[model samples]
Target chain A: MSELEQRGVPEETRTEIMEATFRAVSEHGYAGLRMRDIGEEMEKTRQIIHYHYDGKYDLLANFLEYIIEQYEGSVEVERDVPPCEELDIRIRQCLFGPGFEEFDHWERMKVYHELFTHAQNDERHREIFDEHHRRLRDSITQVVAEGIERGDFRDTDPERTAQLITDVIHAARERKLSLGHDDAPEEAVQAIDEFVVDSLIVDE
Target chain B: MSELEQRGVPEETRTEIMEATFRAVSEHGYAGLRMRDIGEEMEKTRQIIHYHYDGKYDLLANFLEYIIEQYEGSVEVERDVPPCEELDIRIRQCLFGPGFEEFDHWERMKVYHELFTHAQNDERHREIFDEHHRRLRDSITQVVAEGIERGDFRDTDPERTAQLITDVIHAARERKLSLGHDDAPEEAVQAIDEFVVDSLIVDE
Candidate 1:
């Protein structure tokens, strides 16, 4: 069990709070968000939220971990999926994000990036973001390594290639959500296909 | 003269205010920054800052344009430089950022990304960020097109390639500054060299 899970908030209640936090952040933004705002999104009273989490800062710190966990847990593929296909799915998932019942992909990403930007000034938040980056890069590296071992991809530096692909996916999302560049994400996928992915595949 | 220039603030004083804003934002962050904080960073009093700009929001809105202007003006290469060299210099400048006397590149980028995040909620700030993104991508596109015309680059889609390169540079900076992934920027440069730049160059 994760450290956060061990803190005694039940898994279902925690998921509810995370979803409410997402809604609140979507409406109010990171700087302006309040516990009351999150409470309003939830069916429960604000006292319930305060009972579980200490305050706005504490809740947000936990919210950061919660959202990252959601993303980490959301990515699932068939066991029989090939490495090349798996890599493509993972890249697309990062770029487009997974489907959520309450919010669209970009909506969740908007809140995610807001929290991400806040990490610059907050040490705890920065640590969380650093861990997420490391995990993401490492996961992509693993896939690339598997592809190479399977004779499906050209032999290249998997770590560097993963870093490159991860950065591009991140930048494309930032462009789409932050700058309102509607075409940026699709264009990024195409570029990755032509440049990064094509360069990875070996001749049949 | 630009609309901002025509608003009656002298060019030199505007630059000073912009620099002060950068320092204040760097110190206090976007959410915590105040007019007095900016005044403290400047030689002038708080009233001088108040006299020129309406409030913290207005000052920051202008500061967004000011830093973008600084970056736009800072990219200077000799007219005789070839397109490929110019492209390399521009990419490096974006990834590493141009040297500033007051603060280093990442310091400036930290503040820039802070304001960039604020743009998600503010319409005016969003417009400024949008304009900056458009200009950065277009400049890179122009360089790529020139390189192709000169036969220095292969026949690839210049617009798409430029967008890919620009996004990677942005992501690299964000990773380095926000996540404290110190190696991200240099690693991005390496990946671009092998994947993007080498792919651009025509075979001997």
Candidate 2:
């Protein structure tokens, strides 16, 4: 059972609170975030939010976990989807999907990046952020390994190649976050399609 | 005259203050940074530091400018260094350089990342961070253009290739900042050297 389940929080209530936290982060950029602000966004009293969370840190930590769960759920491959296509879809979601343009999605990603940067100094933040990286990178690595086993890709180091693809997608997102204008999923797709995926193509 | 020069601050005094800012940022990260802490680091009063900078934001804005200047100075190619080799060296410096391992350098970078995350919501921070990206990308673009002009590289789009390389270096740094365990610049260097630089190499 998940933390929310163990705490007896209904999934609907948990999601509403998460959305409220998202709004708070969007307005304040994490550094300026306050539990009261989140509570206000949710149309609830701070005490009500406090009942659900230890404080801002605990709420945000669970928010990170919630985000990972949502992402993992989104990227699950269907029976009909080829592993390579699935990988491409995941890259698109990360690099240039509506996530980059939709204000809510963009803000959520920005908050995520903020958390990653903060993790450099804080151990607890590092642990939470690292889990996200491990899950995402491991998922990509598994896809690449499967592709190689299916003879769709050359015998390259699956782990390193996955990391390279992961790095590129992240770099693209970071660029968008920092510079505020970039070729969206197109540049990212091209980079991955040409450099990463193409590099792994097996010769006939 | 430059901002520092117009202020009539002596070069020696400016360097000392910059070093103090670096130390303060290392200890506090940028979000927690206080003018008092920086002044204390320099063994001066807050008023003395204020005489040089308006406040925390102003001081850090100038500090960001100072860092970009330092980085630009470091990446300058020598007259005898080949353009391609010069580019490789720059990648090494950015991605896997001893700079990332040295405590002072690592902390400074962490602070820079913090500033960047803050910039997502702060206009002033965005301006400072954008200048760094523009200068760095422009520098990389120039090298790629030079390589193409000299026939050392194929007729690839220098601008896009430069951005690709820029993304790789940044992604590598972001990975290190988040994961805390990654191949020292070697992985980044290899990714660029093979995927980027090799792709641009002309056939004999």
Candidate 3:
């Protein structure tokens, strides 16, 4: 059982709070978000939220985890899928983001990056972001390694290639969200195809 | 004369205020920063700062411009340097950052990203970031165009190539600073060499 499960917070209640937190953050932003704001987005009162989490920081820390969990969980593919196809899906997902029913991907990413920037000041937040970064790079590396083994990709360092692709996807999202460069995501997809994906594939 | 010059704020005073703002933001962060905190970093009184600027947001808007100006200005190369050399220097400078006497690069970047993230809420800040992003990409695009023109690089869309390189550098720095992945910058350099720079060069 997870720590959250051990704490007696029901899975349904936790997901409700996470969704509320997302709505609140999307509306008020991280700096402006309040328990009251989150409560407004849900049927529960602020007291229940306060009872479960210590304060704003604690709740936000958990929300960050929840957000990462959602993204990580959403990166699904069939077992029969080719390594290159799986790699492409994962890369595009990272760059363009997964579609969420509650909020737009970039909207959630704005809040995510806000918390991400704040991670520099908070140890807990920093650890969470570190884990997220590690998982992202590792997942990509795994796909690249599979591709190499299957003779679909060149004999390159999987870890390094994954890092490059991951960083570009990250940077592209930041460019789009922060700088309002509407074309950054599309441009990044094309660039990845030409530079990264093409370079990784073995010549017939 | 520039708008700053026309505003009657002396160059020396503007630079002093910008430096103090940097130090203050570094200490307290963007969300926590105050005019008083900025005042403490300066030899001049708070009233003097108030006399020159309206409030925290106004001062910060100008400060954002000033930070971009410092970075844009610092990206200098000798007149006769080759396009590839210039591109390499610029890329390394973006990923690793330029040296500054008063503060560390990553430390300052933490503060910069904080503001960049906040740009979403403020139109003025968003415009400033947009212009900075454009300039960074354009300068790189120009270099890539020159390289292709001289047959140093393979024929490719300079704008697209530059966007990819610039985004990776930005992401790598953010990864290093926010996630505390200390090796991110170095790993990015290696990735760029293998994926981007290698792909761009023409084979004899």
Tell me the TM-score of model 1: 0.96
Give the higher-lDDT candidate: 1 or 3. 1
Clashes of each: 0, 2, 0
Candidate 1, residues A1-204, lDDT tens digits: the string is 876788999988888888999888888778877778998998877787888888999899999988888788898878878988898899888888889887988888888898898888889999998998899889999999999999999999999999998999999898888788888888888998889888889999
List model 1 lDDT by residue over B32-70, tens digit each: 777888888888666877888888888888888888888
Give the chain A TM-score for each candidate: 0.94, 0.90, 0.94
Q: Which 10-residue window of candidate 2 chain A scores lowest in summed lDDT? A: A96-105
Give the alpha-carbon lDDT of every model. 0.87, 0.75, 0.86
The candidate that achieves the highest TM-score relative to the unseen native structure:
3
Question: How far out, in Å, is residue A1 in model 1?
Answer: 1.3
Q: What is the TM-score of each candidate against the true structure?
A: 0.96, 0.91, 0.96
Screening candidate 1 with a backbone cut-off below 3 angstroms (N, C-alpha, C), the clashing residue pairs are none
What shift in Å separates residue B25 of candidate 2 from its native position after superposition?
A: 2.0
Candidate 1 chain B, which ten residues in sequence have the lowest lDDT sum?
Answer: B41-50
Docking level for model 3: high
Candidate 3 Cα outliers beyond 4 Å, as residue runs = none
What fraction of the real A-B contacts shows up in model 2? 0.59
